[model samples]
Target: MPKNGAPTRTRILDAAEALVIDHGYAATSVDDVIAASASSKGAFFHHFASKQALADALVERYVAADLEMLDSGLAAARAAGPDPAVRAVAFLDHFVGLADGLMGEQSGCLYAAVLTERQLLTSQTSAPIATAIRAWRDGFAALLREALPAGSPIDVDDLADHVFVTFEGAFLLARSTEDPSHLRRQLGVLRALVETALAAGPQEERR
Candidate 1:
């Protein structure tokens, strides 16, 4: 579709995604995307209606990729262990490792960023971001449901929500403090939670 006969749309979205990851949504610009993607205005307009539309596309792509990685990691973790509780812990540990590796000393979360940057665009632009966040939360809940012991009475949905909030906060803290140990402690807390849940045995339910 581009006059240059390039993969302009993908190039633009990919460029936007990378820039948003590094500089964040509010801080990035169309010019930056153009420069990074090496596309002309004609090509950019051909793909996206506006900067907000491009951002929406980028966020959707980012969320999809992220969910895939999380799903894969959780699957790998479950596959690595026999006990359901152990598998859950392993999955949480893998998630922690992923957070450390991806963000490192960088500040901010992609989801948190989208939520925060929603003010920059109109209400219509917010739907996709909100949907992405909800999907992520639901995905986590589903993982917990799968990792729970057979006949366990624990509300997997609630537990997953708690875990998601805790994990998100821990990542934020680690980034803010530049201290990885904070995240380690948080992950330890999650492990302890899983251990406690498992301790309830086959007959007990979450309190």
Candidate 2:
């Protein structure tokens, strides 16, 4: 819409993301993205080498966007000196809001769809997904670790991993059921878990 090549590239990725969410990786072809994006084949190839490369680029773009959103709200909450529980709630609020919009779409998570046919993605493509997942987990772990009292023995990394998987699973269920309530219910459970984990850490810890 910008009437420029950069916008064209973005359009290509946006179209590819939707198509991948709708049709999936193997089912989607380069021609599909070009057509959906209203861009030329040359333009598509100029941006990516192959369909695999395009998928990788899409994943990278998607993850970067998500991380940016998480950082923006979490950083604000940290600076405001909110207690760990409040900060945790703020984090989930931001995260759930993002996922809610994505789930509200007819097409669900682009990566989750591609994950069904993950074999199609080479290691190069998978690496970004793995990295994004790890970074998200680490971010949560850091928050939880800070929330805990001094010398608490809880394993924040493991807890964050569990929470991440729970969140992803809930999103999958919500998408499959076309029920946003599934995600909301799961977030409630997670919020309780975060509070319990923090409370169980140390008695001296306070807001």
Candidate 3:
């Protein structure tokens, strides 16, 4: 629906995404996005049918970028070694480093910010957000499964969910407390949990 050039659209999205991260979705208006983008009202409406349409586009763009980053980290970790357990530890190390770097720069996760406003969003606007979250969880679960020895006592799927939860919590805590070390400590706990599980070896089923 955007009548303007791709550059114009990107500009609008870029401006809008930054505002949403700093100001939450409910507080960000179309006019605000237009003003930030330095585009005319017509240009804004042309690219997006409505404010919700803009929201959907932003979520899609952010989610895609997030997945790409995660995939890159995973690939790097996998390349570090052939053993699943080793790769698993490498993945956590890579992820922790990524988190530390982002926190160091004080960059908040867009998906986490938007999720807090989900009640204000329509299904059309929220579906992509949910899908992105699921993809993240599934990706981590796959890595955990690969890393754990067969019959390991720890539940790979559950641990993956915990990883997601812990990261989100860490972000909230770090932002609220103005301390990136909160996230670092949480990642430490995550590494410890993974290491403990790996050391436990496979478990036998009880009769």
Q: Count the backbone clashes (under 3 Å) in each candidate.
A: 0, 0, 1
Candidate 1 structure quality by residue, lDDT tens digits, 1-207 = 355664778889877777875677879988899888888888888889988888778677766776777677668666877765566677777766665665554444566666667554454655665565566567666666666667777787677666557756876787678776666577678767876775665675449
- Give the range of the ten consecutive residues with the poorest summed lDDT in model 3: 118-127
RMSD (Å) per prediction: 4.9, 4.4, 3.8
Candidate 3 local Cα displacement, residue 79, angstroms = 0.3
Q: Which ten residues in a row are the worst by lDDT in model 2?
A: 98-107
Residue 137 of model 1 has an lDDT of 63
Error of 1 at 191 (Å): 2.5
The collision pairs in model 2 are: none
List lDDT for all candidates, in order.
Answer: 0.70, 0.74, 0.79
TM-score of candidate 1 against the unseen true structure: 0.70
Model 3 lDDT per residue over 1-207, tens place: 345455889999988988987889889999999998889899999999988888889888987887787787679767988887787778778877777787875456677767778654545666776776687678778878887777887777788777667777898888788888777789888988888887786777679
Best by TM-score: 3
Evaluated at residue 97, the lDDT of candidate 2 is 57
- Candidate 2 lDDT, 18-93, residue by residue in tens: 9887777888889999898988999999989888788778888888976786587578557646687667656766
| Candidate 2 residue spans exceeding 4 A from truth | 1-6, 80-82, 97-99, 118-121, 149-153, 201-207
In candidate 1, how many Å is residue 77 off? 4.2
TM-score for each predicted model, relative to the true structure: 0.70, 0.81, 0.85
TM-score-best of 2 and 3: 3
User: Which has the greatest lDDT?
Assistant: 3
